[model samples]
Target: MGIKSFQGKRDTSQTNKAEEQILVSDYMTTKLITFKAEDSLDDVIALLIKHHISGGPVVNDKNELIGIISETDCIKHISESKYYNMPSDINNTVGNNMVTDVDTIDKNMNIFDAAFKFLASRRRRFPVVDEHGVLLGQLSQKDVLKAALKVKGNTW
Candidate 1:
């Protein structure tokens, strides 16, 4: 007689269900605090504090992302001003200090790939955009964490 197997057949449907891809848009924060290039750095700082956010996207009149402004950037500007013994210039614009070379994520990208990008780039957040490069939302490290938690053992 042939040897009998003890384990039952695996559930292929369950495996497929667990492997269903999660997209960045599913967890990105659409309601973002955006700034204009002409916006005053002081105002940006105040808003960052008010919203308890470390950074935000800089957009144009059409709401297309131009750059990113962060607390670190503001701090650097402030430090330079103090180092040079120059008084804070209220006229300093976000455009002057914001990071222009931004790495953006595709809204339809897989969440796992986004997590890898975050790890490789060491970026706290990435602006999610469409084929037109229109700013759709932002995906932060925390958002990735939330996605991981949601999937948990199902996909991990």
Candidate 2:
């Protein structure tokens, strides 16, 4: 019998379920925080602070995933930039150093792959991309954690 069929045999479908049926798209956050490559660091920071988000997807004008920007990126820049040499328009430029190369996944990628990527990267979330690598949404650690808890039959 198939896994879903086996799941149907369970007494309580609400709990004791396996993760095989789950995909990143099933739980990924569709409401994404995104920025263009040309957007300023100051602007990105304000968005992050306002939304209380740790990171955002960096996209091209075509809405393709170019990279990601995180609180770490901002902090690293702030700590490393020398005050004496700092440009007056530092807030207007989103420096190359502030963006992280995107490690993206497709909407159909299995949950295991998403979980593995999260475990491997320094990022707690991944930008989901389309077949052509366009930004679609994001899968966060929170989503993965929730799935894990559900599999383990635990309540939040």
Candidate 3:
């Protein structure tokens, strides 16, 4: 799962030999603003707004990665509340609206795999975890781009 273990995906246009040489840990952001599953949607929303991020990773009692909640998820909650004439801030917990079956990447994974994964999905970021499933950091599509730009032989 380290940088050297990357087996470049042959079919991905965004992947190259250089990207395969980088590890996800090298690019993942460790300073993260996270949320808990038991927190209210309003709480998550306020924090997200304060941070100016679209979403954040959800952790459990042990501070392990559990799910994810995003602006899109919040909008869905708002829409549901509106349709029911309820307030989003009143009684909804992040667990009720978060996507539990989250797609995560191991921190040991390479940039090529990470880039291809992002290319295949609509996710803007992925929660990076260790082999034990503990939260470590976050990998964003932008981070992958930086890896690409930093590759050897590439012009700035």
Candidate 4:
């Protein structure tokens, strides 16, 4: 006689459910602090401090992303002004100091892939954009950590 099998068949449905992709949009922060290119650095600094944020996206009048401004950039501008003996608070604009070559992530991108991108780029946050490159939201390293924790039992 053939050997009897006591264990039931494995549940493939559960396996499939565990593999569901988690997109960046689900975890990204929709409420963002944005700046304009013409915005004064002094004002930007004040807002950054008031909101306790390290940086923010710079946009145009049409609300399109043009660049990114960070505390590092502000410090750089201050240092340069000091070296030149110029007034740091005068004529400094976000457009002049913001990083134009900004790297963005797709809203539909998988969370794991976004995490990999964060690791590769060494960026604390990534701006999530749409097909037209409109500013939608921002995915931060903390968001990725939260995702990991949520899916730990299923995916990890």
All models: lDDT? 0.90, 0.74, 0.85, 0.90
> Could you tally the backbone clashes for each prediction?
0, 0, 1, 0
lDDT tens digits, residue span 1-156, model 3: 656647665565445543555889999999999888779888888999999999999998777999999998988988889778975563488888998898999887878788889989977999988877789999999999998888765421
lDDT of 2 by residue, 24-101 (tens): 888889988788767777788899999999888887788888778888887766666644567635454554644655
**Model 4, residue pairs in steric clash:** none
The candidate that wins on TM-score is 1
| TM-score, model 3 to reference | 0.79
Judged by lDDT relative to the true structure, which candidate is superior, 1 or 2?
1
Give the residue spans of candidate 2 off by over 4 A.
1-20, 90-92, 152-156
lDDT of 1 by residue, 1-156 (tens): 999888889778878877788999999999999999888888999999999999999999888889999999989988888677897675378999999999999998999899999999999999997887789999999999999888857676
The digit string of per-residue lDDT tens for model 4 on 1-156 reads 999888888778778867788999999999999999888898999999999999999987766788999999998987888678997564599988999999999998999999999989999999988887789999999999999888857565
> Model 1 off-target regions past 4 Å?
82-85, 88-91
The alpha-carbon lDDT assigned to residue 46 of candidate 2 equals 95
> TM-score per candidate, in order?
0.92, 0.74, 0.79, 0.91
Total residue pair clashes for candidate 3 = 1
